[model samples]
Target chain A: QQQVKQSPQSLIVQKGGIPIINCAYENTAFDYFPWYQQFPGKGPALLIAIRPDVSEKKEGRFTISFNKSAKQFSLHIMDSQPGDSATYFCAASRFNAGGTSYGKLTFGQGTILTVHP
Target chain B: EADIYQTPRYLVIGTGKKITLECSQTMGHDKMYWYQQDPGMELHLIHYSYGVNSTEKGDLSSESTVSRIRTEHFPLTLESARPSHTSQYLCASRGGNNEQFFGPGTRLTVL
Candidate 1:
């Protein structure tokens, strides 16, 4: 069913620029959205997350802008660095599904981002 | 550091061999999960557990079986390995809201 879908299978950006990645989901029951960053040969780590209640949330140079009605969210990385080159995954989950909402993540395929210096 | 470990990081075996991938977490979390991913593909959940002695199948139907005999340990076993079963398996744990911590993963190749 691919409840969540992400765009731009790959992205290329320069240092000190903003690289944006977008995602959209079909399941309205989903209440939480999280972004994960994965490097080569490593595990995916939580980058930032947002609840539907907020229009936007920012952590340092990373920001998540969410639009509930549109069922969409995007990640913005400011002053992107070469070290930031990696794969990004957007995931969604429902808090009340099957019992404890202990993070059964439905993920997007993934986006490969490249930051050139 | 919060430790979530997966052992046998890489394994290549002939078909029909029985194999088990081990996962353990030191953070004392009650929830655990197993996901399978192909190269450059989305992660698909294959199994999960809420606590010791509890387990459930996930969205993707898998030939793997799992057990939670202890709170920190969750091991996935394949009765008979096949070429179709080759994939990278990831283990994760979370306490709430699906904010999971993932292990490096076990990449298995079945010939």
Candidate 2:
């Protein structure tokens, strides 16, 4: 079973527009959520992250809006640029300090975002 | 940037060949993970380790085996390569903040 589900496998937006990618998880035990960005032929890089305690978190042009009750979270990119085109992934994990499962993340299906100039 | 490294960024092998993918990290993290990803699909965790001398299989059932003899090294090996094994393998290590840092993936092609 896929622990987390992401919508809109691909997205296209103009350079000044905003692109939103959403994800939902079935496990309530998930406490940490993070987003990653990947270019072609490269590994995914940490874009931003959020804890369930806060409703939202923003870093630069990237924002994460998390809804705990609904078990859903979305990433919004403000003032999208052509360089922002890449694959985005959402991941979730539960805290397991000193345990075997510690820091293991369950990833959602990736979203291919394309920004046009 | 995460100081993680993966060797042989790309590999192609014939059937029944034995192969090992190398992963190393200089971040001094206790947790390391191996994930498999196909084109346009989600990443599946195949193996993970919490610390030196500790290893565990992840949710996905894989034919690969992993060893974590040292805190900085985690290697995955396949006894026999098959065409079905063709995919990208990603290595990651998690620090105290619980955020994972990924290395440049190794793209494997088995014939």
Interface RMSD of each: 1.7, 1.3
Instruction: Identify the runs in model 2 with alpha carbons over 4 angstroms from their true place.
Output: A96-100
Tens-digit per-residue lDDT, B12-41, candidate 2: 999999999999999899889999999767
Model 2 alpha-carbon miss at residue A54, Å: 1.0
Top of the candidates by TM-score = 2
Cα deviation at A34, candidate 1, in Å, is 0.5
How would the docking of model 1 be graded?
A: medium
TM-scores for candidates 1 onward, in order: 0.95, 0.97
lDDT for A111 in candidate 2 is 98
CA lDDT scores, all candidates in order:
0.91, 0.92
Please list, in the order the candidates appear, how each scores on TM-score for chain B only. Answer: 0.97, 0.98
| Model 1 TM-score, all chains together | 0.95
Candidate 2 lDDT score at position B69: 94
Candidate 1 per-residue lDDT, tens place, B39-101, comes to 767799999999999999998999999999999999999999999999999999996555789
